[model samples]
Target chain A: MPEAEAGTLVLDCDELEELAGALALGAALPQEVAAAQAHLDGCPRSHTDVYELATVARLLAEAPEPVEPPARLRARILATAREDTAPQDAPSGIRYPVSGGGGPVPGTARAPAPARSSLPRRPVFFLLAAAAALAALALGLWNLQLRGELDQRQERLAAQQRFIDAFAGGGRSVAFAPAPGQEALHGAVVRRAQGPALAVFTALPRPAGSDVYQLWAIRGSTPQDLGVFVPDARGHHIATLPDLTGVDAVAVTLERERVPAPTTAPILTAPL
Target chain B: MATGDGPAVSDPDAALLARLVTRDEAALAELYDRHGRAAHALALRVTGNAETAQDVVQEAFLALWRRGHTYQPERGAVRGWLLTVVRNRAIDALRGSGGQVARVLPVDTLVLAATDNPEAEAMQAVDGRRVRAALAALPPEQRDVVELAYFGGLAYPEVAERMGIPLGTVKSRMRLALERLRGSLRAWERDA
Candidate 1:
């Protein structure tokens, strides 16, 4: 129907990240695996590459003059390890000097709380996991209710898969809460530990003609421009963040034209 | 090393891992005592904060403790896994991290520390020259992407976004970069 829709989307076969990941995790299609195997069958170096890349990665860690961790940290970590729970699910005591406040709720344009972001504690994990699971479970039930609309079901499944993969590899996601009146809008900032954070929004009301929605990474005082996007006909928007290395929070705003800076208050925000 | 996915219980770290699976605290301490410094230093460099690094390394070990059963020694060395875990944790810690910024990563300033990490000391002693040479030989842009992914923990997609390059380009660069490094790294093995 549209010129832009002429081509089909395909995974880049040569993407090293995807290839290497598929090799290690067995996440690739059969031929992909075969291709890798045929290449590595000569020496079977793929798995070992994980460790070898890890060792090269080790060179980075070993760089930067070793600052022997303070002796007390040893005592503290060892003592915590001795908790006898056989790897307590995210020991609460791990993050010493916890950032007390949960950071201001996103959408408030509040101070970026760097201290606020810490690894998801056990309860946080359980709650987030529960929420995600409930979301996924609910989608299946919803699919059952709506027997038709196969396209919508596929989209829902896609979203659910994105949510699951967000939590994969020990990454975390922050849910986006829209204004109370805007119940239809939904989204999340998936902070991937091993990759770029993703800002996924669904049911985003299409911006009026020529206007677009822009994503912004709100650092302390500056808002770094991510990119502007228009959701597909299905009103689904997923944007790849460059990386959330030092981002405080991420937000979305409506723009008549994507500008170097935000011209209006953000319509949505997810505090990292 | 066998290519098959066989249990490497005979490996020293494998032995420690077995003890860890058995819930042996002594094993944890032993593993920590050996790798803890490197782990801590790795986290510290990544997060650039002492407390956070401690927190990261602690969590990584705990995760390793929990997930140690999943380790396949034929995949790679145990210490490599340990370092990668700590590095990932430290990188995760950087999200929404506070205080004085290293601003951007100083990719050029990477300097090997005085000896302490046994695996590092050994690897650095033998393979350091060749590996460093391999890494240095990579195109500045290619090396930058690899360093960003490996040291910064940004995945390839993130690296593409950071460098404003196409995903294909990033992958090709890394494929080339790692191919060269693999040649150098392939020679230095566990026994080597």
Candidate 2:
């Protein structure tokens, strides 16, 4: 058993826990480090544990860049905003005050109107006919505008397809095998030549918290990282990899960052 | 560089975001000019399809225009929030299309210019690997917490809710996870 040296306070599990918490919160000051160092200098056993915890704290300070939203999403959201501005005449579920000489409200019954003399029925008829013609014209114009917008959208889509065919390179087919217990992740591979190429998707268990599945390519001695990918609420994911050649196998493992990379190994490996 | 301009301002993204909120067409183009490359790179990285990534960039900006009001500076920085949304959308697309995994050629295999010398592409590839390795080395509990917060982009409370754990546990786990990652990265830097 490791013994504490004389004149130094030996930290137990409780003290180590406190230190870990402080380090994680970035609340561990230089003074704390000095105090820890002084204690560690006297008690070597506590030194390694405290130092390791402190290092993990430091890495958390510089977290990786946050994930970015897609481009078309902004357009879609803007379109939604535009839609919100359009007038909606849905029933408001409230009763309005009736004005003088008006019949009963829409939901209420009313007495019949009395006979009227000297009213110009032809002018009222003409007004109604004119209003109908204006409505028809408005409808025609609206239809034309809608058709034009639809045509423009289709043209843009066609242009995009052409651009993709010219610049995105010819697509290729690849196969991937999931790690041993990840039989659910088995899927087909689509390959692109330029840029960050390679992606995989499958239905699997949703990882706990912010943890996501990371893909790795193992070739003999080297373990190359693809990238981190998260599955949806339904436990489905599509993972992308950095370009690499001569990869013998691919694996998806639950990964999280650690200070002073630990000697401990991976929890899962899906061999592909 | 334009003549007579003072020192270049850092992070014009807020201005771009504000203009986007107002539905300014020119501002949208300028926003693209400023962040398009980075956004494109990220989209390409996540989707592994240049065409899709390009589309994703366009779509994300459009979303910014429509949902700009939802942006609250109190929640986080604009860039971080935008990136988060973009990544989520890209992932949603990949899932929809049933994209493949393990087909990517390594970054070193590409013949693109290294003009940025120590180009972000190369660095991303290396750093991504290092980060992966470091993540793999964490304890299961701590690793899961860190993963949920970073890659999954869940808030601390959300992580707790998803994991069915107490909020305090999630926070502590996150703290531990970050500490471990930092230590590993430091060691990695030293060795490099």
Candidate 3:
């Protein structure tokens, strides 16, 4: 084995270990590689070792080309875009025009209509008036129906907004209510946060096999695991997360316990 | 906020992204045209499948629409940032598809196979096959450690966790593995 000569390099086995650790992490320093290479020149064993490692590194840097995406994905994406733009259930409102056509221009030429001097019976006017009244009534009813729908939609939206706000605040406590006619779990908020510190909890169906629930705090660029908790026999449980400040979102996942930490991807998330 | 004469549109990405934020279908289509292929390629490489890669790319673009405001141009070019996003999304897809590790071939496979092509001019300078064969000759355990670290792009702690071994053991194995591989590759080169 070609060994590092006495004065070729100052690094010891422990130093080499650290270098290996860094290399394994893909965080190896360029200077370290150069130093190792220089040392290897005088030491045959070291030279061979460093060279092989370099080759492997080069190979990794130039891995095979990735697979191409299929064409159908574009259609799916566009469909989602269309769904997002679909109008909500808001009633259409009419607005009076503000000023454009100057009050009948005085100099504008007007075509004269042929004169109808004959005055029909008075009952004809009454019949016309009655028809107009009926039309007005129908219009009123249509407006009322639209107003009613708008009011209902507004109420539902307000309730949903409140729920989302409560979650964003990190409600103080959470409770899980069982879903109707189902053995699974449903979550609810008991107390809402004043700002962005609300506490929330959900009931998850008891995990089958060897799985546990993992909580995560996702902010910019990375996802941090909050912790793991197991649900009780009733399949209801609560896990308190740290402050939600600067965290863009939170999610829960059913993961294998052996994994120990939450993966970068989330399995399920509660919309906030 | 503006770069003169690079592209006709000022802050083209931001302008398009703002429209996307409002759920503008046309703007989204434009973005897809601009960076779709590269994003798809990255996703495919990381996920190792065409279908999953497509999903990852779509998900990544959707995420960009949802979170484009958070992007800071100071960090790097938009293309790099997008690539990073696609990479992460692909990795996430791989992880979510269950605990089974994605099958990524060792880099040596690419290098060695390249050398076999008769028309390749670059192969004349470097005997990539010999180097790859040398790597293959190592003990399976050591080879796996090296491959997972370098090609899999996994950190030491991750490799340790994946292999169910101690961190110290992983480091030692890597050092020994590299030393042996290097020795063998050098011997092959000299003999040739």
Go through the candidates in order and give each one's C-alpha lDDT: 0.53, 0.44, 0.46
lDDT of 1 at A143: 79
Candidate 3 C-alpha lDDT tens digits along B106-165 = 212111122223322121223334545666887998878876665454556667889999
Angstrom error of the Cα, residue A178, model 2: value is 48
TM-score, predicted candidate 1 vs. hidden true structure: 0.43
Residue A43 in candidate 1, Cα distance off native in Å: 16
Clashing residue pairs, backbone N/CA/C < 3 A, model 1 = none
> Can you give the lDDT of residue A72 in candidate 3?
72
Model 1 lDDT per residue over B1-192, tens place? 131111122347777887765657678777777677767766887687888988887887776666565554543456655665676456547754442211221111111121323443345333234545667777798788776765665655667789999876776676566666655655655436
Q: Write the per-residue lDDT of candidate 2 for residues A1-272, one digit (tens) a residue.
A: 12343222344444545544443232332223223333444444634334344333222312333234465644544444444332111111211111100011111111111123353333445767888979977898899998998797667545534533443367743445433233334333445665655444434456545444555555442344456666676544555555545665564445321111111122234333
Per-model DockQ against the true two-chain complex: 0.13, 0.04, 0.10
Write one digit per residue (lDDT tens) for candidate 3, span A134-180.
Answer: 98778988899989987976675455445544565554433322222
Show the lowest summed lDDT stretch of 10 residues, model 3 chain B.
B105-114
TM-score of each: 0.43, 0.29, 0.38
What digit string (tens of lDDT, one per residue) describes model 2 on residues B45-114?
A: 6577867776766666655554454444432334434544455455445545333321111111111122
**Descending-DockQ candidate ranking:** 1, 3, 2
What TM-score would you give candidate 3 relative to the actual structure?
Answer: 0.38
Position A142, candidate 1: lDDT:
88
- How far residue B166's Cα lies from its native spot in candidate 1, in Å, is 3.7
